[model samples]
Target chain A: MRNLIWIGFWGLFVLHQDFWYWNDATLCFGFLPIGLAWHVGFSLACSLFWMAAMKFAWPEEIEAWAAESTER
Target chain B: MEYLSFYIVVGYLALLIVLGLVSKFYSRGTSADFFVVSRTVGPVLLLLSVFGTTMTGFALVGSTGKAYTSGIGVYGLMASWAGLMHSVVFFIVGIRLWAIGKKYGYLTQCEFFRERFASPALAYLLFVILVLLVIPYLLVGVISAGKFLQGATIGMFPDLFGLPPLVLPDGTERQHPLHGSIPPEWGGLLICLVVLFYVFVGGLRGAVWANAFQTVVFMVCGVLAFYLISQRLGGFARATEMVAISPFASNRLVREGNMTQLYFLSYGLIPLSVGMFPHLFQHWLTARSAKSFRLTVIGHPVFVMIVWLPCILIGVWGAAYLGPLATGQNPNMILGRMVKELVDSQILSGLVTAGVLAAIMSSLDSQFVCLGTMFTSDIVLRLSRRTYSDEQKIMLGRIFIVAVVAVTYGLSLLLKDVALVFDLGIWCFSGFAGLFPIVFAALYWRRTTKAGAIAATLAVAVSWSILFYRDMLSDKPPGSDELTLFGVLPVTAIFLLSVLAIVVVSLITSPPSANTLRKFFPDERLSRR
Candidate 1:
């Protein structure tokens, strides 16, 4: 899961380029331009991916070190 | 009624001062408390403070102006990339830096670098570079505030404040009925004084509390401004359709001409500047725990989208509503002009203008506080012979904040005529982004030598200076035929040069001492994991 989360992060970076939609002027859902709408979805995906990364991939050791230092 | 918006903005400033005074009562009166709030900030305040500080006038005023000229493609060029990348930086760089800062009692990035590389030279070098980069960043806020105020309050005090027609630097005569009404210089000065007052008294705690509050105000006001403008121009769909169908602006609806793929890809590097921002570094150190970053990391992209989407749309709609702007017309004022012309209610317009001020001032306070922290903790305390009490340290910080605010305001005045808020902002971020390679290497690579870091720093500084000088000489209009390296922004080239310098120099020079490695990269095998 941690590895996959990392992969998703890199994937999103590449996907954000959105070369295909660059010239498209078609409005998505009657308002948003296609390129703009694609990114809106991309931003939402990034939010969810980050949430998952925090839950599954966070390095617990650093938190433990910080807490122990505070205790001292 | 003419001064209603200005009065509401004044009311908001008063509220911030009250909040500052209130925060002083809660402050612990220690240097630690004043600088980082003793690292007691929780998740919610942390989220808002970080977001507020990051979303400066650049996000609101500069962005709208850019979108007006460049079209909806502007969103893809920056907003979406920023949404995904800013959180990435926060997670990857911010968390580790916070843990190290808390453990070693680091109050500023200079302090951390000084200790990590065992080189005060690097720290001093970094201090100069960071301050230079930050001044223009500070100017972005000042310029935006001035332009917004001047643009919004036009015709309000025409008789009292209007000036005789004077030729601008661009050789255009003052065209508006209220040419000098609430001049940009006065607006910028007023914001500087208000922000300095709160940051001086309240310290980091005051700044954070105010940031959270201002974040709410600006977001609400932003949405209201968006909705009201859209309604006035027919609904959102209709406004966009109008822009799409208009012969003068139909090109704005699509990605063509100057919105090249290479140009868009280069913007991805710009958001990395946040990783190296001194203000952001200070904010990270104030987190209660690593868990505290969870909310900020997850919520930042969403917050960015919320603020940016509306501002971009408004700018796109401006192309149709405003028609062809005069060649010398400032785009920074487009959003302000839109609100003034479209939003009919004086009360609503006042609140919306105040909201724009809220976004601009939120960043000013944070940057002010961070500069003070760097001066007091990183430079003065480190170099002083005599020890000082917490109160004295706080006193020195407050004094320096005043000095920085004064210097920034003076610079803003000199550059007010020529600076495009968005262009100036991109240049500032480019300088910082070029330095990102050093920060990343410092945190992750145990073998990174002091010489290598210095070499990389010099690469960024030299490349950025030359590029900025060339861009200025070109004197081309924004987003059209400015200096580029291989058709992408000079930032991409500068970043690559820094990376190359770091790698080659680190391989050639001896690595950092084992003690230093143990300290910064403890559990080296598991560092990446």
Candidate 2:
């Protein structure tokens, strides 16, 4: 799960570069520019990736330790 | 109808004041309550305040103007990069900072630094550098608010504030309608006073409450403005199609051969500035639990897209509808001008004005409160060596807030002519980005020494200063397209140098004491505890 999360993180970073779309001015969804449309998808992907990260890769032990320290 | 926008803006200000007074009723009057809301902020308010502070007038006004000149590529340059990078920072850096801050009751970044490295000198240096950088940032919001109001309310008070008519290229004279309305200085002053009142009365609590309210207002109004303007130009599809074919702005729809791939990539470094923003650091500490960051980390990117898409699109469309801007025109006013020209309902116009004010003031209130917190906790309390009472500390903080507000407002008035909101804001963010290496090292690197931290801080400050002076302040400052070094943004170079300095210095210098390492690294200690 952690490795998958890491892969997703880098994948998003690589996909965000979108060099092929730089010159593609074709409109998507009637009005959205191809480049702009690409990013709207990128933004949604980021949200989902982060949600998965919180569920799988969150530093639970560290947080538990901090809470324990407060109690002590 | 002419003064309708102005009246709505005034009402919005009144609402903020009422929110502040109401927050004061709940405040415990302790220094902790005033500074970090006693570290009890829930997830929703935390998300809104952090998101609101990040957006500012730069997102709404400056972005539209930048999009006008640069085209649709503006969205790719900053918005998309910010949408992704900010969430990464919040999840990784923010959660840790919140945990440590809650453990130690840290109210400001410098306070954490002071304890982490056991170096007051480094903390003081960072405090000075942060204040210097933040003033320009505050100026961006102030200048944008003033310009937005001035452009929105033009001709509303024509008898009182009318200017001479402008001669067009076609030999026709157009009346300067802004003649009898609120001037930029007055607009800036009103915003400054209103922010000062709320921050003075309610402190960080008031700022956060108002930020949540303001965030909702701007997002709704932003979409409304986008929809109304698209309709005014034609339908959304037709509006964009016209620009795609028009001689004046067809080039804006594409980025081929103009913006370099390296340059577009360098913008990824700019949003790293949020990692080092003192205001954001303070906001992070206000979370009630480490899990409180979950919503912020997940929701931030979508919120950024929601706010930025409209502003960026409106800006791109401006080039087609408004044609070319006249000489000496501030691009920051393009968003306002489009609304005034196209969106004709007085009530709708007033709503838009209030929305812009909400975005601008939401940021200003937090920054004012943050600076005051820094001054009181990091500087005055540390230097004076006196155990002052809670009331006295709060009073001192309010006084410093007033002083900082005064200085920022005065500078905003003087720079009305020179301020380019987008460019100036980018430069400020670059400086902050350059400082991110220090903070990251502080949190994650067990071997990072106080000396390395100081060296990295100095390296970022010195490099940022030299680049800014050469590129922006020099008598022959480079044009926008020419500001890069070897075709890459200066932020990339500055960030690299700071990272290099920290790594080399840390390896060469004596490592931190075992006790210091244990406290920060804490895995062993965690198991023992």
Candidate 3:
């Protein structure tokens, strides 16, 4: 799941830039929208993705750890 | 040189001092207050402050020097692109770091990383590397400001003090001195006074509030300087032609240039360490919402567009005029010389110089504040598990701040080879690039064990220590080819190798106890964070 989110983040980064400075890379393979709206939306997706990752990675870990420590 | 702009400089200086002192009352008040502005930095001001901090006078001076030599290579332009693109990561990873920091009440990136990775050892390692590498970046800005000061107040202060004549680059082969000779320390002292004034008072919060104003001052002044110099030297088209015709014997366009690739790619790696920076983590923590973090990044590209245009030209102009003159001088000083030569008035030169100082000092405070907090709070106090009164913690932090500045100041004076800094920085980040994956996993992947985090982090740290500065490990100075390899291959290899190592190790390792996950990612903590 972390890998998936990481992939998504890097993928978005690759798509956003106009790094086609060279003629060989001039293929206009547009992936996302242009301008501020696109920027805002893309960031939202990333934010959500990270939030979900945190929760998934440490599911109940906080509470469970707290309880165990208290018992000890 | 006209003396009218001296008023602008004086007014701006007064404003900077007033702004710093006033912010003491208004900026955040606690440890968290000092570090993260209570996570309540607003948009307009936050935008300005962040931009001001990101690009410094080095952008003004050194980049101009590169442009002066390289002509109008796109490398100069890439600063904005890199800066703007940095936001995309901020929008993505930034919110995660912020939310986590808020949840844990973490003051520094080290604390967050320690919690997330369940590896306090690795966190300490990171803190040290961050402080060390970031010092060079800070000093780059300081040195640039110093150069600007030495040039700007040449005539006016002579009568007032022991100032001397400047070797005007007026087709003269002679070297001259300014009012008394202003060295790097004196200029550094001025920069330190202004930056320390605000940062000590308001901390990051004050810096945040003041940066917005400084950002405007830096940018408008930078663009104005670029424009005046470009026109004085000849228009942009002719400037390009001069670059095309001159000794820029390389066939690469700025976009296609060899260094360009390194710069753009190196910039992309900036985000790799962004989640790990103490200052940025502070900003992330204070965020009202993940939305703020996202907005910071999304809004970044626009700032890139606005700031990069004028800045790239300064470099271009400097490259054209001073390419031959950059014998022993720092490439970054190209713009400073151009400014000194092109401007007619002492006042305008002084105002522009003040703006340059503002740019450099702005970059310095964030690092000073962030690193100081990390050293004092996370490493010293947290490691000792000593609960300090607020005043004590603040005092510890202040001492660390002075300590960091003093050491970095000494380095700026003693150490000349700055490229070593970028090398060390990349090396340090690469040491922990392995943790970046784990950080992502902690945010998302539930199966990630602390053991797995430890395994990959150690593997990469060891690997980076060897690979990142492998050339420096040798007896001989690195050849261009070897430097090029280090520039691209080794760092890239470490980044990739670390990710791979983490995945393999995590699969082999015992799963993190469910309890660990629960405490690390408690559902009830949603609104709390």
lDDT, candidate 1, residue B224? 84
In order of appearance, the predictions have TM-scores of 0.94, 0.95, 0.78
lDDT of 2 by residue, B1-529 (tens): 6667678878888999999999999999998888899888998999998999998777888789888888888887888899999998997789888888887678899988888898999999999999988998899888878877787777777677778888999999988756766899988998898889888999999899999999999998889999899999888899899889888888888776558888899889999999999999999988888888999989998999998899989998998888898986877778878887898778778888888889888888888989999998988888896799999999999999999999999998889878454368788899999999998999989888899999999999899989888777777634444478887899998999999999999999999887776666657576566
Predicted structure with the largest DockQ when compared to the true one: 1
Residues B1-529 of candidate 3 have per-residue lDDT tens digits of 3565656776887797898888887854577777787777666666677667666665565555555454333432345335434664465466556656666567877776676667778677767666655776676666656656666655555544463345555855442455543555677677777777787877887778777788888778877876677677676555545544555422222444434445446545544655555566666665655545434565565565455546555665455455556345666556666777776656557657777777777778888888788788777798676688777777788888888777777776665335554335344444444446656666667777666666666666676667644555555554553433445545566666667766777888877666567556645344345
Error of 1 at B242 (Å): 1.2
Give the number of colliding residue pairs in candidate 2. 7
**Candidate 2 accuracy as TM-score:** 0.95
Calculate the i-RMS of every candidate, to one decimal place. Answer: 2.0, 1.8, 9.6
The candidate with the higher lDDT, 1 or 3, is 1
CAPRI level of candidate 1: medium
